[model samples]
Target: MPRVTFPHVAESYRSFKMLMEDLGNEVILPPRPSKHTLDLGVRYAPEFACFPVKILLGTYLETCPKGVELIVTSGGVGPCRAGHYAQLHKKILHSLGYPVDIVVFEPPRLYPLDFLHNIQRLNPRRMSYRAIYECIRRAWRKLQALDNVEKLTHKVRPRETIRGATTRTYRRVLEWIDRAYSLVEIEEAERSALEELQKVPQDPNRDVLRVGIVGEVYVLLEPASNLEIEEALGNLGVEVERSLFLTGWTRDNTWAETTEGLTVKEAAMPYLPELLGGHGRDSIGNTVLYAKRGFDGVIQLAPFTCIPEIVARTILPRVSEEHNIPVLTFFLDEQTGKAGMTTRLEAFVDLMRRKKAARRPA
Candidate 1:
């Protein structure tokens, strides 16, 4: 069995490992993105490649030497450069003298046969159809459990009376979820995790700024890539709600397009009217939805030089003005500094607080 590895794309790696192992392959998990990873990526990746791509390159470089023979990654659609990352990574690795195979799971709508073939390629054991379905089912349950814990953290973090309590509990819950197997274990882990989060003492009457996170999925989901903006905001007494989660993103791209009875395309119709690739359309639409739902502000995070987000950023100001919602856009890259991001977030939170105060009854 070939040893397979996947790029770190958030907490999804835990679930991905379960899927690969169940399929009879040895899964080597990629290292979480860090300074060394970023530096490695920047050193070898193209000068203009986006942050996620660089981080992915860095991850592969770190894992390939560990006897990884195959790389499995998702493909993209529209104008996003992500669609080409798998091929690009393969060439770069081969040019550098590594002989690893990469199998990309392209959009099922565009390349149905290719998608199925790629799945089969990853199944070196040639597991039965029923077995493969069961593996995918269990993996999906785990992914959902992980996403729920993440969302709960956002709600609990800002209100927690004990500083860092939510973050600590969140990490513990993630470890428990990772160790879980089977649908029953996954559900039990999720239930117990949510209960643990609820136990964190919180100031229910405290006024907290409600902020919606919108942007490229990678930066939105990956803490290192976004410099842990959600935790920063929570520490500043802000409640964060993210527009993208791995489960929702996977469902939309693979099976269902509508979320909560509304498609991002429909929501963004008045502003964008078409997919600009990546999560550009979703960013614009979710921002609009946040404003309507009475969120205090919205922060959009994206990789520097990401074209889709650049387009979205240009249009975001208009959305802010028309919807009367504050929107802050951060473009991240290897050079992005945590200190600068923290300062900006603090200022944004202050602005939102003042805005909220002004709207109150005198």
Candidate 2:
């Protein structure tokens, strides 16, 4: 058994922990978002790598130094740099003198061929079928619970006292959920957490705007990576409805890709016949989903050099044309600053506020 470091603590952490523990390996949760982690990534990774890749690389370096034997992560391939990160990380770690084995779960390209192979590789110890099934069930539960928390947190934050308090509690609940023996227990825990969250008092006058944020997964999750985009939106008197939280991504979207590809024909049929790479299909799906859900607007955040999103950029215009949804795409990099992002966010919020205001009956 190898000591593992699960990077990116958004929503999938618990699921990964359950699966790894089922295989009888010790797992250490990665440190929370911090400058220390970001600095490690910025200093070690290539200049053009996506923020998430850099952060994961930095995490690997730190965890490997602490004696972790294997670093398991999902890798995507296609016309995108995301697919190349695992190999790049492997070389980077080797060059830096870390002996960590990089086990990458290949993302589905044409179908789920690579995905199944990766799953087989992950369970090399040949654990019993029942045990494996249990692990997967636990993982799925963890994802659903975490995603529910994320969705509800965003919906309730503008109406709560402490910002992101629900998110913090959800993390603790995740660790506990992995250990729960039954689904009923998990449901009870969620109920209790939501009840506690509702107790937090908030100002009724606060403007709550349901703005949809779409883009790269890292930018959506890592506050530092995206200059605390969600908080900025919250402060701007708008309720931020993020589109790329990991729990929904891993459980709904990623899991679907593992099989014959889950089709969201009901939601985004007009955007079908187009699958760019990385999250191109998801972007289109989420765009339509957000629009139909009555979000004020959408913000697509991706690294400056992201290819899949660039391709998505073209498709989204057509989506906007069809749905009359306003989408603002931001390309981020090392040069992106908080002040700049805030200014743009403010403008976007102002536009959304005026648009919504016009629709209300006087």
Indicate which candidate wins on TM-score. Answer: 1
Candidate 2 wrong stretches, greater than 4 Å: 107-126, 161-182, 202-207, 245-273, 314-322
Q: Least lDDT summed over 10 consecutive residues: which range in candidate 2?
A: 253-262
Q: How far is 87's C-alpha from truth in model 1 (Å)? A: 0.7
TM-scores for all predictions:
0.95, 0.82
TM-score of model 1 (CA atoms) = 0.95
Per-residue lDDT, model 2, residue 38, is 69
* Model 2 per-residue lDDT tens digits across residues 94-137: 88988777777764565477666656656757887687777777
Residue pairs with colliding backbones in model 2 are: 76-83, 209-239
Error of 1 at 59 (Å): 0.5
Q: Count the backbone clashes (under 3 Å) in each candidate.
A: 0, 2
lDDT of 1: 0.89
C-alpha-based local distance difference test score of model 2: 0.71
What is the lDDT for 194 in model 2? 62
